[model samples]
Target chain A: MWKKSSDRFEYLQTLVTEFQDTDIEEAKEQVLANLANFAYDPKNMEYLKQLQVTDLFLDMLTEENENFVEFGMGGLCNLSMDPECRDIILQNSGISLVTNCLSSQREETVLSAITTLMSLLTPLSRSEITHPSILHCMLRFSLSESPRLRNLAAVFLQDCCTEEQVAQAEQQMQGQQTAVGIPLPQD
Target chain B: MAAPVGNSSGCWSVPEVYKHHEQRKVCISRPKYREGRKEKAVKVYTINLESRYVMVQGVPAIGVMTELIQLCALYGVVEEYRPLDEYPAEEFTEVYLVKFQKLTSARAAKRHMDEKSFYGGVLHVCYVPEYETVEDTRLKLQDRRRYVIRTAQNRAREKEKQERSNEDPTTSDTTTTTEMTIVEYDKTCDSDNTGEAQQTSYMSHYSSFPPLPLPPQEHNFYGHTNQQGNIQTEDKMGTLHNAIINTKQQLQKSTSFSQNSSDRDRGTEQRVTPNQASAVRFVPRTAHLENRKRKMAKEATEISLTDVSGKNEPLIGPKLPEPPKLDMEDVSLNTTVSLIRNTMKQVESVPDLKPLEKKIKPRRRI
Candidate 1:
């Protein structure tokens, strides 16, 4: 029994080290995906927390490569399901970084960002998460033509924020709204 | 963006086939330690990738929709099923979309049905999240979060119980490290009360996770420890037929409890009035737009009522105080003022009446 746990720890450590040492973008993406899939299992949550993979995922949010942002966002979305990992993400100021992905060109990335935001919700972080600007972004997303995006944004609005907040955001939207979730211009 | 798949009107639009639906090549070069029991492509599974609406492709076109649905019903209650006539398919094959009542049921159905051979056709199943409505998406995430939190709390409680039991043995020096490890290791070996012959092989590995606390009430209904380990060995041996036959029996027993509860809820729902039932089924797209418009209209009235100065105030900041009431020294004048004020309120409430009227119009038309 102990041997299996040690084997898992070693395997995760290998992936983490490979992610740091490899310069090739493809390898890094694969390893990032590997680590993220591992995070989905609750049994591996303690090991992932020990490896500081939360910080690794947070760092990927600001990269120029869209794949990095998407895969990393996906990893955080899965990891944040655990309360322990959610606290670590909150401590790292993950709210602002994840919010930046709201405007990503890739729909997968935006979807992951929305789910990660919902999972990152805590009493202490509620105000920042439900900030007027974020709510404004969700308001835009709730009207998105893509049903997946519309549904997730609706969940965020319905579950994460109060009805008054949504109403206020809607009112503000009519006069002047921020460009948070609008898609980036494609070259 | 993918088009909406189907609506409550029982009509389906052509669904855009997504990249995730195409299964990638199985990654084979992983070192022995990193490989899971089954070879899988390098893709991550998140809540975004899962849905109660699953798409099934490669079904034989020989009028087998009932047989296909019955196969799906083995996993859970099939809420809705329809063949996607517009979706592109291979020659002599068809595609179908099935919506299970619960996400877990969809998952189990996908796991069991995908890549399995049916009547002269191989089935390929994948989650089609684009087909879900906003309410379905919201309920899925809420249920997943609640399940994770509940399991985490249970695991933590079990750990605490194990620690307390270990502490009772020795109160002296070396209370911190070695003895605790030894005691935990010992418990793993001794805790296999399930003398099922199939479990004896992999019982050691399975013992570490679920039954760590050992005594009081661990072996009630969660046959997970029994099936998980035995299933793995069965997979490796290429006897999936036996593995499924053995596990399906146990899976159905555990899943039936949940099905019974859901069925009771469905029974109560059947008792609802037809109008209410239709309302629950058909959530109009215009509903959100109308809700927002209604709220805006109400806000406008509120602003107009509060700002007696008759100027639009910025929606932000503290609301303006109501204008002071005019007074008349004569009783006849005071009564006249009250009458005017009552007439003004009735006029002001006219906008509020519009929303209710609009609401009833949509319901009656549907």
Candidate 2:
């Protein structure tokens, strides 16, 4: 097991170095996919942290390249499950970056972003992660036509928000619907 | 007198006659009344000394003509105004030519209005030279219209290009491009796999070559696997182990490539031999593991043992036998009699307390 872990660590370090050395978009994509896969294993968490892979992933969240952002968010979603990695993400202001990804057109990217947010939400970060606009956005997402998006949004609301907060959001949404001249059906 | 020179039907005019000394002599031979007409001609020339036209640009979109006239009214009366109408409605912005009553008034308007902000844009006012005829101004306006139309078309094209790039990932063409690139990349990896397969084939000819590394892993994790692989029950774990080892080797090669590049950048003459590279990589991996193990052990000790023990405790306890019931009727009879006697004694004290309460209420009244 120790030998296997060392091998995995060396492999991930090589991928990061290759990613930095290459200028080709295709090569970068391959490297990022590999990094994201390695990130899923809990044993690689410390190795990745030493390589400053978290910062690299965070940097990709703002990239114009769709693949870069998607793979980056995927890696973050995987790594954020570890408590140490979660703390690192929070300290680096990863919440705002993950929040920005909520509007991504890619379903996989958005899903990963939501999970990353859920993982990073501690008592201290509850207010930042559950901002009013974010709550409203999630409320809208809960009613999405796609069941996947709707289910994820429902989970986010249930896990991240108090019942009173969710009820208040529903009232606000109803008020907006009425102001737009759309009537709601009574139960 | 040069009067006849001015009144001549087909002869030299007064100004023309004045050009030649001999012609002037001939003009002087004419009547004196023509002399008065020459004075009027000279007066007309002085009155037409400078142009009164002013070119005003940067007119606002709303009510441009009216607003321009109102803006110019402050300096002098506008004798006539012509706003260029050659530009198409959508592309047209404002530029006007106004004829003020005097040259001095045109100069004043230019000084007061040039570079001043009007509506949303700046106004540029300048005098139109006398040599610039209406035809020249019209041609200039047509040229401006063409330029504006060309630029508007270019802007629309650029905006469309940007939108296409932004929406590329969702489009089928982008997916095809990415797929094609991945297929090309896989071919290179396949070549490497074929070499490895050839080596492994000698061990067991019946076994098919191991599936390519790149495709199966990505799809498996993404839950998009489309094919199932057959593995012997005995070799299932062995194949999995081989696959892991292969991936790890590939990663080592990639990182070593970067280290080589970094070495080259540092202007070092020495090349990194495989032994040195492996040694350098090995040291960090072991050191990192040791540090992690230490940290985990420390955390384990820091956690209170009571917390772990408490979590293992059960909510319910063992059942015990119930106590036997006792007959209290005989023993309670004397206790009740004593309780009644004690109550009667207390009641006797209540009468004494009543007098104190009455005394206190009367003192309050006082």
Candidate 3:
């Protein structure tokens, strides 16, 4: 079962690419294939650690923005939690392209793109700074009127900053700054 | 600026300095960069035309702006705007007709006039707004745009071209200096050797300048009159003839491009020339300046070389004079991409004789 699980990884990627523009049933096959390959396979564990997973996740960034019904925000969340995918998200230029999708029409698409961006910054210094300009652009987007945007920004701001960086920002804010969610963990 | 005062010699001696004031403005307040609000903010661009530098948009002139604005609007930034009064439908109706017309033809006169006044107002609003209100600021930050094609069509008026190089003429006449930039290009690639690029560059100058006698004269007068572009008008031989004439004129401008190239030097055109090159004023652009210059220079160099050679050979396809670089010869270039860099070899002459036909042939193949 474990050997069979890893063997299907290529098929899963193929399914994701092929059905990316397809209907709900076809997309479920893609997700199930990925979940099985990722969750059940043990012999393929080392393969799971490679940058190829990142390439696969990054490919989803270009998937039809119209197909949220197929691979929705959940797909984005699943990829974010994966370490290999997370590292790639931080390093790849395509991650910015995903974050850029936050400006997309669908709320789910926007949320997922933002979540992926925020996820990279969650484990601080895990990757080199993807882009300083993008971070500033995201912050600019966070000031938006969309409640979804506000909540995502709030969550991202809480999870993203390192303790030392936040401390400095706090000091700069002086006594007037109000507290937000979880403060950065002390090293 | 000096005001001349009559001194002992009876000739007005200008005072070098009056009440000296610094030329820079100090901004006391930053415009409200409203954050974290669905509140709209304007992106303002101020272009100091500086009498010489060209207005810049990006690729494909009008097309780039349309794409950029369309994408932005699709993503829901702010409403991308067209200039307050672009062309009235009537006059604009004939644009397709004029499109076929050579750019330098008389047909472009009206369209160029409209675009000038329209762009000037839009540029002005972008630079300054009297009111501090966001609306006022937004109005000022009209997101006005202009595109600068990589080609030579970036020149402005004819006089501007003449005046630019005419400011200094010594460097303009030298073929060695003209060859310097071209020679610097890496040779060895068949792509670079196509010899068509030179023709395009020459023709590009013509395309950019295509005689506009009206816009400079219009001076802020944009009247609305819709003419041409009806079903009957589209089929007329007269329209086609006019377009071919216009295109031919643009081609002529290409051949005579040297006459006005110095004029275009003020705007995006100068972006091509080094600052030092700008000081070398050439004659007003004329058709075939490049051909004449290249032909003349080759003749002079061959004449000098013929005396050294024992036998007389036609200058045509004569062994290329070893250019400035001696080290570059026989350096095995790694790839086709790298070969374009070795421009010191016998750089082929440009070739694109019939641009429309070439442009059309590709679509048929596709």
Candidate 4:
């Protein structure tokens, strides 16, 4: 069993190395997919951590390639549940990177980002997560057309914010309503 | 922005807080104790039993307060209903917090109404706990949501781990080694070789057959068809030859006139020209035409036989005598006797039916 795990680790190490060295988008995508698959197992967390795959995923978040962001967020979402992985992500400012992913057009990327945020939520990081802009985005997301996004945003709102804060936010929204221009006529 | 800042200040604004508190007065509201005025405290009325407040989830996007109240009224008297409108209009449909007149009704609503489909979504109805405010409920929901997500993640991870561990150690090690080697090869291979490497790797994973050799570029089009045509022609010729030989032997053995005709037809069709031995490409088309012609001839024979039989048969059959009438009275009597006997046997078998019949007959007569 130990040997099997070590072999798997070696395979993952090779993949990560290939991912870094390969300039071909397709090869990078394949390696990212494999890494993401491996990331789903908790037992592989030690190997992944040893290989510093968490940093690799974090790096992919800022890539121009949407697939990289998607697979990266997926891996982070899977690994974020692990305390060690969570700490590494947190130390690497993964919250901002993940928060940036909310604007992603890809639904899966957005979902993985949301779940990763949920997984990484700590009392200390609550302020950063509950920043006004993030809160506003989540509030809008709570009304999203997609049920998954809505429910996830609702969960974020319920879990992350207090009622007082929500009410306060609502009141702010109402007050800002009047400051904007006049309402346009509806068709 | 001004509104949020104003609302933030409104939290400290005593009158606004009071106004907000006023809306929930009919429902159970937590009382505030006077700090200094312990002596001669005024009497307060509080319902001793649990409050009739129910939190109803899964409201449809277009649902209104009245519709919710009407739906809840089926179980009990809904005193009031308020849809939580904290979310923006675009974000989510409103979820209702309903208050009933009685605790029994609230409990009944929770039991019968919970998890029922409201519109397109399932309803989640439950009594509001005494101490948990909306904020606390949200917090609890958040915690439950986290727990659920974590559990799901753990389950997925455990399943993947189990799958990995269940695999044969030797095979998995070899597979990993091969996969690593392929990845390494892919890295070292030039762009032109990358496609071939990928194809080879894919074949290695799924198939034992060696990767097929690429066709020469000059012969790409006809190369495939030439191979296919040769195999097909060889199969068709062998089958046709065997069939012809068997039919000819059968014809030599048969003494029937129709068999003789069919044998002549077969012999004419089977007469090979000088080019027939090398005419593999033309065989399939000629064979198809011969088969069709034979089918047509058989169909014509069948049609002629059917027509001759129809011409020889009469158009209508001779009339027949009517069936005898049943003796209704005798049949009814027999059935009644048999039914009574069956019932009597049933009564004898189980004596309990006798007393039941006795009570039932009296009631019927009365």
- For each candidate in turn, the interface RMSD (Å) is 19.5, 35.6, 33.5, 38.7
On DockQ, the candidate that comes out on top is 1
Better of 2 and 3 by DockQ: 2
User: Any runs in candidate 3 off by more than 4 Å, and if so which?
Assistant: A1-53, A63-65, A68-76, A122-148, A162-187, B1-366
Clashes of 3: 43
Q: Please, what are the lDDT tens digits per residue for candidate 3 over residues B1-366?
A: 111111212111111111111112322222232111122111110111000101111122233344323322221122113321222222222111111111112122323322233322211011111101221111111111001111113222232456556676543433333333223212211222235553343233223432111111222211111111111122111233443443343223222322222222333234333422432232112223433554465467536544542122122211111112223233352232235433312242221011111111111110
User: Measured by TM-score, how close is model 1 to the native structure?
Assistant: 0.61
Candidate 4 per-residue lDDT, tens place, B316-348, comes to 101101011112246665465557645554644
State in Å the error of residue A127, model 4: 1.1
Query: Measured with DockQ on alpha carbons, how good is candidate 3?
Result: 0.01
Name the runs in model 2 displaced over 4 angstroms.
Answer: A1-4, A182-187, B1-366
lDDT of 3 by residue, A101-121 (tens): 654654445555655564444
Model 1, range A1-187, lDDT digits (tens) per residue?
2357777777777788778777887778778878887776666666676676777788788789887888889889888866657766776667767877786877788889999998877656777778776776777666555668877887788667777888987776654322233221111
- Model 2 Cα shift for residue A35 (angstroms): 0.5
Each model's fraction of native contacts: 0.24, 0.00, 0.00, 0.00
* Deviation (Å) of B76 in candidate 1: 2.3
Clashes of 4: 3
Candidate 4: tens digits of C-alpha lDDT, residues A97-180: 787788787666776787788667665666667655566566656644344455567657765666666766555444444443
For every candidate, the chain B TM-score is: 0.45, 0.22, 0.17, 0.22
Clashing pairs in 1: none
